[model samples]
Target chain A: MNLSGETKLFLGVIIGTIAIIVLAAVIMSKPTPPAPAYTRNQLIPIGANTKGNASASAFLVEFSDFQCPSCKAFSSVVESLTEKYKDKLFFAYRHFPLDQHPFSRTAAAAAEAAGKQGKFFEAGTYFFANQTNFSDEFFAKAASVLALDATLYEKDRNSNDTKKKIDDDRFFSDTARLPGTPTFFLNGKQLILYDSSELVKAVDEAVK
Target chain B: MKEKFLNDQMTNRILFILSLLGVAIALYVTQSFLRKTPIVCLNSGCELVRKNPASYIAGIPVPAFGLIGYTLLVLLTFLRTTSTKLHKTLLPWIAGITGGGVLFVSWFTYTEAFVIGGFCTWCVISAGNMITMFSLSLYSHSHKK
Candidate 1:
């Protein structure tokens, strides 16, 4: 019953190749799932941090945390898209500070405070650009750089209004069942962010 | 004496084949992750399960780790089949690796079923391969010496 070593190696290769081919065929035969139906709802709120035309047909909402590295990475992309589609897209940012980041809430409040002075997008950009610096001094410096009223910025940063705005956004995110930071919603439908190109494609589809 | 030799060769052949299959599965999954392509699936749940943040560890995709594991197993199997001295030396390590792989498969299966509430067809197949490989490796080891 002894077999030559060459025979064993050849048999092993054959068996392995057949197994691989079968596996590939099985995977290829799988049916692709239909596109998921996203529920349309009113995700916008009054005084939300927004850019672009309010009446644009394509509405893009971002649920992001300032202290989240991924969120910071996505900020520039979001900004570029907003500018590119300024005439046809409306972009909004909502706070979703994760509990794991100790400075996330403070950053969210800082952005909201800047929003009070009609500089939400600018403040947000600053927070994302300097994510490693999250101290109060840094926030104040951002306000100064933006030429916001120093005294008003400090007061508004700690105001009940700023806290409420952030809290409300968190509540909405929870209700929508968002899994993580940097989640995007297009026209009230969630867009899975596997890649930035996916976001662009979704936006193009929405625009069409 | 010839029957025993033939059986051992057959066992090694089976192990090599299974290890190859494992590498193929790992490679396919890793490719999907790297390309950011949706995993092909007969079930609607593959997307849901794969999109979860838990699908990755410390920014590296879980399948990438799987690919490494399978590659190591393939190397070990190849060495075992080619050299008697290395075969004896690597047999225990192979057994431990396959055993760990089975346990990991079990944990991930439970996580996908209960925690994620979705399943990837590829993942399930890979887990099946791991279980078979574990069982066969144990059987071969037990019958050795």
Candidate 2:
């Protein structure tokens, strides 16, 4: 076939366009290793449930859902992260209850309620451990171990303030376009965790 | 063939370039979305638009449609520039395809702004790209020989 130079050039452009797009996509989509910890602790919102150092420049924030199994697995990692980095790193947890999990919203409220009584992480453990059995009954049993006043626990969990707090966190997740629960932000940078250990790596980098 | 197409091939050239740009932006958004990597937005809107149930139509990411639309526009514009015989025939196809592209952007932009309450900057760029290409095509179609 006798093709003009114009036709050949057009074909070249098309091929080049496709090739460039594919190349760029491959590069951008590569799972980013934990971003070098560039901590912006100010991004940690006021009133967020937090642990570890209050004034530390290095911090980690997580938006998690209690009924999520991956979140359950991750909570332990965060638990140890807080302990290991105590007096050095700050950690904050925010609710991002996905609708697919029936008990996610309730569990988030329960966590908030626990936060009021200085048992946020403890309540989180109970919810994550008893993920399958989430309900008022299970929460009441969990609250029993927290040594919280039963009446206050019940009242606090059901209070409007607790509901509003979860709603605010939910709104932030929606606004941030958080991909899903168990999403972590090291300092202010989002971590692309291909492995659970990335959290530790990220915190280590942040503190350094 | 119009003297305009022969002498002033500016729209054809520009449309091709704009459509190519659209392809790149749409490709990035589609892949970022598929990989579940958060797009860094000018504001927080990208996440809201991306993660919304509305972002997927029949399990297909919305930007995938933009990618297809832009790619088609690219091909048609390229064919028009290369083949004088096919030039007239390709103009209407370019216009029609871009018209559809505009409509697609309109729906998503509306949903993003009103329903989802946010919009991605890339989506905005794509919307402008389609609208500009469509306008240029309209000019090319109506410009007198």
TM-score, one value per model? 0.57, 0.54
Kindly report which residue stretches of model 2 are placed more than 4 angstroms away from their true locations once superposed. A25-208, B1-8
Best by lDDT: 2
Instruction: Tell me the tens digit of each residue's lDDT in model 2 across B14-78.
Output: 88889889988888788777876767666445655766667888989999999999888888877
Candidate 1 deviant stretches above 4 angstroms: A1-41, B1-62, B65-68, B74-145
DockQ each = 0.07, 0.09
- Single-chain TM-score of chain A, each candidate: 0.79, 0.79
Candidate 2 lDDT over A1-208, as tens digits, reads 7777766777788898778867876776577555444345334667889889988877889988988755765778899889988899988898888876778888888778788889898889878788768776777776777888878888998999889888988897887767766788876887766346667787888888
Error of 1 at A95 (Å): 0.8
Model 2 score (lDDT): 0.79
Clashing pairs in 2: A177-B47
lDDT of 1 by residue, B60-90 (tens): 7777777777777877877776567877778
Query: TM-score of chain B only, all predictions?
Result: 0.90, 0.92
